[model samples]
Target: MSEEVIQYTVAPAPPEPPRVPVRYAGFWIRFWAYVTDLIIVGAINGIILLPFIPNGGREFTIGFWTLTGVISTIVLYLYFLLMTKFSSQTLGKMIFGIKVIRKDGNLPSWSDLVFREIVGRFLHRVLVVTNLLYIVVGFAERKKGIHDMIADTRVIHTNK
Candidate 1:
């Protein structure tokens, strides 16, 4: 029998660029961010009415509720406008080092913010079925709430 030898050459693997691991914030942090926002907005409204609180024992009236509704609307509008225009961060978000940005990582437009804040949020608040659906959809997504999807935005940790 003749002896035979075979040689095999292996190809070099292509070089890959190093990747920086992305860190996502947890649910608790996001929840706290919402709490902070609520507190800040509530405080603003409280401060606005602090001077008008009567010393007498007058029961709250329909006018009071109406005033409150108007103030709340204005505050919400201003909050959304400022966040969309100024790097997608409300005062609470800025404090928490979280910002809202488009899913593609771009600044959100005015229309997007308005739609998310007004229409999406209103629906979420009004329709119980829609609210449940929103929660389910948000959890089903990569942690993006319905409003975030409607606005094409995401909340990311700026400190990271």
Candidate 2:
């Protein structure tokens, strides 16, 4: 009897690039998430101001509008600051299963949160052109907005 020998060759597996975890939230989802947050915060502000608003004012004054704007800005800033520092989620983000974190997957410090949520975010909101530019960049540049670049942070889906 003659024995036959067979040789098999196996190809090496391709190496994977380092797994950088990115959340990759699309434009519409992010937009809706922000809208949800705005509604929640706006409702809170309205509740706080219900007593002060005149029942039948002829019209809103410039001063009243200005005051309301200032108060709303402060409330938004505080909301982001607290959520980013403590739990990495605003009420909407919490409900939507998203979170903010450092690019390196660490809990952001108070200063980081403040700088990111307050300074960067405020600037983005104030400059309409820049905000529009950021939306373009977010679609073009791996789902990161200008504020995220400035703060070296990212938004990711949270399991909880």
Candidate 3:
């Protein structure tokens, strides 16, 4: 009895689509964006709260905390919080063509925004050492700052 040998043929695997490279915004660009944001915030506060400030936004009402200070803090927090929530970017970021994104590639949740914009940023500004933590973005592999690390976020350049 002669047995015929059968050969099995395997189909070639499909080719994967080319991956687009993600560009992380570096420290200087982020710094400039932050400066722009500060200017914008300053303008907003100047226009809206100038009359209410006791001593030209420098009066200390409670242990270095003035009415202007308090109001500015509130506005600052609200600006970051609302802008990131609605647009995933502030006006400064828009000008710079950068945006905040979650590392998991999902839409950022309310908790993420609060943690990043409010708690993390507050910590950075509240302490000198923490403020320096912003420098980490320059060294981090993905260009994440302390706030981005805390919130599992990253700032990336968006296609304009």
Cα lDDT tens digits, model 1, 4-49, are 9999999999887665443444456666776787788788878886
Q: 150, model 1: CA deviation in Å?
A: 1.3
The global Cα lDDT (0 to 1) of model 2 is: 0.75
In model 3, pairs of residues that clash are none
Whole-model Cα lDDT of every candidate shown, in order? 0.68, 0.75, 0.89
- Residue 1 in model 1: lDDT: 100
Model 2 worst lDDT window (10 residues): 58-67
Global fold similarity of model 2 (TM-score): 0.73
Q: What is the lDDT of residue 3 in candidate 2?
A: 96
lDDT string for model 2 (19-64, tens) is 7656655566567677888898899899876666666865345664
- Model 2 alpha-carbon miss at residue 127, Å: 3.5
Better of 2 and 3 by TM-score: 3
Writing each residue's lDDT as its tens digit, candidate 3 over 1-160 gives 9999999999999997766677999999999999999999999999878788676544658776777778888999999999988999999999999999899655578999999999999999987888899899999989999899889998889983
